[model samples]
Target: MTKAAAVLDYRAQARRRLPPFLFEYLDGGSYAEVTLRRNVAVLEQLALRQRVLTDVSAIDLTTTLFGAAQSLPVMLAPIGLAGMNARRGEVQAIRAANAAGIPFCLSTVSVCPLAEVAAAATAPFWFQLYMIRDRGLVRALLDEARQLGCSALVFTVDMPVPGARYRDYRSGLAGASGLGGTLRRFGQAMTHPEWALDVGVRGRPHHLGNVAPALGDKTGLEDFLGWMRTNFDSSVTWRDLDFIRSHWQGPLIIKGILDPADAREAARTGADGIVVSNHGGRQLDGVPATADALPAIVDAVGDALTVLADGGVRSGLDVVKLMALGAKGVLLGRAWAYALAANGEAGVAHVLRLIEAEMRVAMALCGRTRIADIDRSMLVSTAFQRQDSL
Candidate 1:
């Protein structure tokens, strides 16, 4: 197909390039996906305020996040099994992000190990961690990140219990699929020779690199899900933050926060930042979209810690919209994954340029030349309205 001109274009291309199961995993949200739809719909409602005459000549999209300079106020959010989207996919994506002057957060469940990503990096990137029941394993992973030169640690607290992602079950990504599921997936792979050759064949040893040692002999994707189901620390509480703080000596970001109370608690825990997210609408089905939840949370702790937001971000306008809502930066999830699946490092690179270019035009039109100048003022008054006020 012709080159993807926009972020959503890559999504369409990815659907054609990836196997059905993988595409569904990248595309689908939890349960009925009500919150998923709301995430985009609410952001779309906040229109930008435009001006004509103010010097719209120079647009500055550069900003600093977690002590590192970024070309755009956007980041590549961690996606588990993102490497399966292309050959050494996470590596390709990070390289692309690094080239574009943005940070890429590596997932704990990534197909490529941290060491592999670090080996390919010219600039330091961030790392995301889940609180598994095995503290020893968690500590080991932290030590690995320290040694690998990861600049930040994104501690995700949203997934104490995995959500019932109906798409995963239907795609056989979750639950016991048995022999029938295996055969069906195999057939799907056969139909998509491109993904099969690049990822299935060339991308050898598809085990989740970070947790492979604990797998012992159980090395299949199903075993990875099984390990996740069993090891996710459902009993975790705020006390666990102290434990994590003791080990990691970098920027500590608490992600998956949606409430003002939770944001305050995260700041109290001494987190460097917090991501206002509903886990990309992949965790709970009915929670308010990140856009809806951001205002109150930012009001509560915007000064105490950096407030980032992510959910249904598909373009530079979405990035600008989140910043206007008071997010320090926006984390791109499916957008980058789609680019990686559709092409590779190049696709990701191209899509990032599109976002940066779009942000430039949007900022120019809104009379905001710099990233810092982008605030609720740049958005129409609709952003100031609360749901109950409506």
Candidate 2:
């Protein structure tokens, strides 16, 4: 964690520490990655309207979400294969989030089992579920989440089919099939001795934790990578909402919605909140940035539901920008993954400290003391890519 004061610093550390294939899988998006880059570049385009002499005083980053008050308005977004980044990586991340006074959402494909994370957690965390073909398994997982005291249920609905991640193919993480691909991946792992020791070697039986019951001990890393394509249920529709609502009486947040129409539909489903995301620019390549889509979605939904967002959020200032665009909170995906890969729990804790420090600077310099003071009035407008405006 030396000299790693920012999210990009941690990203550099993670790239250097991880194998080529693991780094590429965590860093790259589908196809040309146009929207992936846009997620960051467009957010940077929105200028902060700085102010002066408002009695240069204190700043507050505290906020309430799903009836729980937290120190910051940031949550760790669900990332598949994140556990491969470090030993019990999700456990480390949740620990960091707990210490930071924020919530951590565990991915259904996490490296650590739900029981393990539940035992380690001092506070309640969120659980994210994908639309898989196995309804019985989904219901069972929901029951498990309830028994474990999950504060919210995040239903990710965008990925009926996994995206065409060309980078993964090039790096031998995906399309490289058969014995030759496995050999190539093994070679890459051997090259990164540090990562090989920490995660690959010591992280034995390194398969998806929550899915182990369903997968039973038959799959390897290669099979794990391709499991989503076959298991995801494209036949799912809004009528299936009751299936989740019936099991989870907690705050149900529907993630991966980018359109106002979809946002409105989510609001009508009696959901507690909706996340305006483009699947971290992973599912589609040319869709509008999450920042670009958030304002209109927020306008369409209004107070109908709590609006959260993810994608291209790299810093505390970026979090402020998303909030100004009307997001109740922002999720950190690659940012936290990089941190976790770089230095495990300490790295994540440091990144949260960085976010807190940066957010305070941004809020105070803009003459905003409270989280509610951050609204659209603080932004200098630009010609947005999304044409629909509220």
Candidate 3:
């Protein structure tokens, strides 16, 4: 594999390495993808106020999140089916993240079970939960996480129901195996022989590990999808937090908050943190970008809880942008996923190195020596000025 100098390069390599069905599943957003495009567009519009001549010799990227020290203010956001990206992909990404001195969040739908990742990981990884209908199952999952020594619980609230990602249907990603619709998928897989060997052949335990025990006899991808569609509780409310809090005493973070009222409500639930995300623009098509919504949410609840943001974060400059907009840290989803798909664990480690280097340069140019020093003052925008007052 060739060296990937940037996130886009890794994305291109991932596109080449992964089958169309898998790549689109990782890349596409919901419906018209208006919010998906807006997420990047809004971030691109924010101008950084650069400064020079100040002493930027000692740049500090260290920060504390959920009472834990980290080298960077970024965490690897949970990506489902990561193991399908490579042989035991979640484990590979976790290893890379731990080596990079950052946190890796394992999704409930990950191919590698929590136990597998926990055993392989040098450090405790965070766990992300998608609320299901069965309260018993939710409790069991929380218990498993606690047993695995997971320090944080990221409860994703936006996905009561899965979004309508047209790409999945178009690519035959949701089609049952041995069906005529999957012919194109098979052909695409054939084109990527390395992925076929690494993920398709070598990647055993391809089923959703965390939820498998509850699934009983139904274990295939199609069955899992059916189970997820049926089990994701659309009726989940603020009351549900009480149930979760009862089971897990660790740091609980509400992941899909974009509104100030919602942020305040999450804080009321005694959540340790709130991630200002629009579900990577995969849930609602018209919702505001994470960047646009982050400042207000931060202003409303920053004092009560730690504020984080995720959406269209592709580079270290983007990470600095989020901090300047009042985010305590940022979560990365597709960026690391692209790296994992492109070159497995090595690609992820390389991407993290690139991001760290880029962030150091960005911080130096912005005249900020530390992560906490970045604020609205480093950004130049009329809208940001108004948000600063908030």
Clashes of 3: 0
Clashing pairs in 2: none
> Model 3 misses residue 190 by how many Å?
2.2
lDDT of 1: 0.88
What is the number of backbone collisions in each predicted candidate, taken in the order shown? 0, 0, 0
Compute the lDDT of residue 90 as modeled in candidate 3: 95
Candidate 1 lDDT score at position 249: 84
Candidate 2 stretches with Cα past 4 Å from truth are: 1-5, 382-390
Q: Looking at model 3, which ten-residue stretch has the lowest summed lDDT? A: 381-390
lDDT for each residue of candidate 1 in 121-203, tens digit (9 for 90 to 100): 99999999999988999999999999989999999999999888888888776764668767777888889998999899999
Q: How would you encode candidate 2's per-residue C-alpha lDDT over 1-390 as one tens digit per residue?
A: 322246788888899999889899999998999889989888877888899989648787899999999999999999888888998888889999999999999998887878889998999999999988998999999999999999999999998888888889899988887899889989998989999998888876687888887777656667776677788899999989998898889999999999999999999989999999998778888999998899999999999999999999888889999999999999989988998999999988888888888888889889899998899998876565233221
TM-scores of all candidate predictions against the true structure: 0.96, 0.96, 0.95
What residue pairs clash in candidate 1, if any at all?
none
lDDT values, one for every candidate: 0.88, 0.88, 0.88
Model 3, C-alpha of 184: deviation from truth (Å): 4.7
